[model samples]
Target chain A: MSASPNQATDSDRSEVTAGIAAVLHPAARGAAREVPDAPPRGRTAWSLLGLSGIGFGLLAVSIVVSVRIGTSGVSYGDLGRSLGSRLGVAEPLPRLLDSLIWDLRVPRVLMAAVVGALLAVCGAVLQAVTRNALADPYLLGVSHGASTGAVLVVVLAIGAGSLGVTGGAFVGALVSFGLLMLLLRRSGLDSVRVVLTGVVVGQLFAAVTSLVLMASGDADATRAITYWLLGSMASARWGVVIVCAIVAALGLAVVWWYSAALDAFSFGADTAASLGINVRRTRIMLLVVTALLTSVAVASVGAIGFVGLIVPHGVRFLVGPLHRALLPFAALAGAVFLVWTDALARVSFAPQEVPVGVFTALIGVPLFLFVLRRRGEL
Target chain B: MRITVEDLSWAVSGTGILCDIDANVTSGETVGLIGPNGSGKSSLLRCIAGLRAPTSGAIRYETSDIHGWSARQIAQYVAFVEQALDSDSDLRVADVVALGRTPFRDRWRGLSHTDRAIIDAALAQVGLADLRSRGWKTLSGGERQRAHIARALAQQPWGIVLDEPTNHLDVRHQLELMRLLTDTDQTVLIALHDLSLAARFCDRLLLLHRGTLVATGPPEDVLTPDRLRDVFEVDAEIGQDSLGHLTVAYRGTA
Candidate 1:
């Protein structure tokens, strides 16, 4: 297999057209910071981040060590020395292992982790912002919004050089966010109203996405659409890694800025307003940030769902709602989750790929529900 | 620190709620607002806190019209602890109290040392220091009410508007909370359903009936048998308690 992580192999890279310029993001806005007095809420946030980072670090090292062991039998002595040769470290061996790690798998898995982090962090924010446990990229219509934009690009046959599917998706998600905010703001910043409105918008866009997919030409188009919905990191490259990183960092920064407001929001709007938050502005900015985060993740992997919704809730169980703690922990949990999940995807059935989205939803949903059940809810 | 309300009126939609009501609170005094349901106790508090926009009236805080101040600006001067809704589950005890610093904390930075100390003090004041790490939703009804008060205390305001702060508090916690307000230098306007607590704690009482100011004076003068019968639809005997404090006993019929 010619699949690589740093940049897509020629066959995989063929899926995405080139020359899309990356977007520059604004400095941090609307982060949920720890209250001046809130002792950092959770040991879990720190433990989650620490444990997951270690897990990924160990796994990455293992993958590198495994490459040197060989396909035949795991050679104990040659493992370190053989790996050293492949990485061009220690001494050059007969074959290169560094190439296998850096180019073939490392970047791809890392991107998967980052993408997962973005989705999960956004999910946490979206759930809090909307005050809906069920809220996520999938439920909020953000993914649908992005997919709508990407599908429009596809139907128009506009390739990467022209605004690109990513750009389209970002705009679509943002537009949906604006619409939801307007609707919810007018209806009284009630939590149930926001969730219900998101549902309506999600349904509307899903209908549009289906119509577009149904009308598209050939089995190839349908297959592409299905794969996109299921999500994958087949198109990871140095350029994508850079762009997505910048965007995700920007979104997280914005979320950090709004941490105080989010703290207020966890109580109802009246309580938040009494806390001296500029509720309208805070709400608008948070919606915008979560939407952008969701869009960027959607653009890269194509509509992965439960990671965003489930990851944050999981983090909250360990940490708490102080978004300052929640957002960062959620981001880390998400990153670690996707990395391992993608690894499972790679190993579960070799050669023919299963979309990472399927596994995430499958794993995240039951797990999140279990957490909720423990907390005494649906 | 002094608050003056003159000719205040408010209406929701086309229906009138509070009509031409006037009240006042001097600095360092606790003013109890007593009224039956639909008598505009909450509406009046909302107007005082600038949560509601009153028509054709002036609420002045130290000679500046409070009506012109934004909610955030008002929050700097006044902390309003409304009745606790179902306790906010996502917040821990300390976090709930620290939110009072929402007016003071920088948007993105961690809380200042002073902010942390004050939050600690507020939690301790409410006897909830031990519950600091406990979730807000798990607290008992009385505890949640106290937590909300602690949140208001975090604001460090000059005036506090409390809408039935004793609503969910048990009799003991209610007395404790009410007594907690006695030492405050800030002017406090509290809405109370229990006239006994009001008579015990308040220096002055503002009685409203159907959005009209029925009486504004000390509890001794305001809690008259006639006023109780007319305003609350109950017959009551009003006299001095064993401690020589004015008290009231409700009878069977209006």
Candidate 2:
């Protein structure tokens, strides 16, 4: 008899493989099962790294191509010159084109990529902690809370500029998250309670937003607030982009560090505890981190939908469920996905730029349905 | 490791689930816990495994009091297999077994070669190495139980605690699992509903009736006809079979 699987011979391996086949497909005796293949040990890591390299390559192409798609007639040549002159390698372009390429287009595209990555990562963390497949960044009501705060600032003329609105939105998000935490203080942060409480909070904030809109009776302010709530990258600037990038990078790193712990949570709280996880503390910490990331994103832009809900599920289908491989791939795929979608939003109507959020849903619904059909859920 | 429970009592709201119970499991002893339904067997096991804090009692694993120890520290000494634990994820058999290495892992490192070796050994012990890549959803009830046992084995703990582990297993699987439990070197405390299986396999038996430890000793002494009638509400005869195995023949309800 073979002692260990590592020491087994070719014949022994075949026998084991045959046994697996028989178990997986009872009706069709020797046929292979169509289940998602678990990446085999040694070379799997290298292959994942290679795939990440390709993803990065695609993201770079997306950024360059998106930067060129506007009514301003700026081409890839103009983009390269602007970037090269900034790095002291090539001659500077005309002043108007330089600012257009260097300041406006660059910041907007980068913001889209960063927000997409951040939302997707937050969604993955929430889904793992709550063990719910439909979880996303907005599941905590942070986006609705942000919308209410922004509306109040816009209609009443609160502090000062866009900075004031951003600040108000961030504060509003934190307050809603604080209420959620207070409600979950005594409970174990179980799946059903977290989800139901989130829905209730979201509804409360949404109602407040509508009430403020109706009371103002000013059509222009209402229109502006509604456009912002639907989500746009037209307001993207260097300061906002830098802040989102810093927060997103840091948040992704933190979530990646807890990848193994997330995998242990598949069986529920008690099983995770028996495997040495501090279930309550881990759940609280992850919820807080995800909420903070989401608050920053919704404050900078509006409540962008679908990136968070769609990307993690799609990536899991390709990489299997271990978060070690899932998180990074989801981040890269999300960055590429948003850059192209934002480009489409800019050119879809030529003179009028649609909200990128609208396009995200316009594209996300069909893609999500495709993923479900592939998984045989439909 | 020896497990000691000193005057353990647990209560929920205002009602008591377990009350002033004391027991000990010496090193390498296989102790069977037997009682009727709702006899506090599951509560007692949870308290011992550090999953629940008792209302009044102290549990000691070896010499250290487990009052302030974190869940990780407790897991390094004792592995617990819960009854009817299932998942709806895409975790494979190997992935499930790798969970047992959670206590020994650092924050930044993947599983080392030593960890993989131990996982392989655990799977081989439970005869599931051939199905390492098989999905959890595709497995039968018996295979799932065996995989969970393999997970406990991969923990390399000094003791293992189980609650109704054989509940949905077929008869052959039940016998195999008992044989494996008896063969292992780790100390075991198991809750059981099958009296004959318990009598034939366990080194000693502990009987609980309505949150009290009514009897504890060798199987024959603790499982007397009068105790069975009173505690379990069953009329039975206790004797040996022709094959020289201790058996319990139940007549009917008392």
Of the native A-B interface contacts, what share survives in model 1? 0.33
Model 1 agreement with the true structure over A120-159: per-residue lDDT tens digits: 8878777777777777766567877777777777776776
Across all models, the iRMS values in order are 19.7, 12.2
Q: Taking the candidates in order, what DockQ does each have?
A: 0.21, 0.20
Please report how far candidate 1 places residue B215 from its true position, in Å. 2.7
In candidate 2, position A127 carries an lDDT of 89
Which stretches of model 2 miss by more than 4 angstroms? A1-40, B237-239
TM-score of predicted structure 1: 0.81
Q: Docking quality tier of candidate 2?
A: incorrect
Most accurate candidate by DockQ? 1
Tell me the deviation in Å of residue A284 in model 1. Answer: 1.0
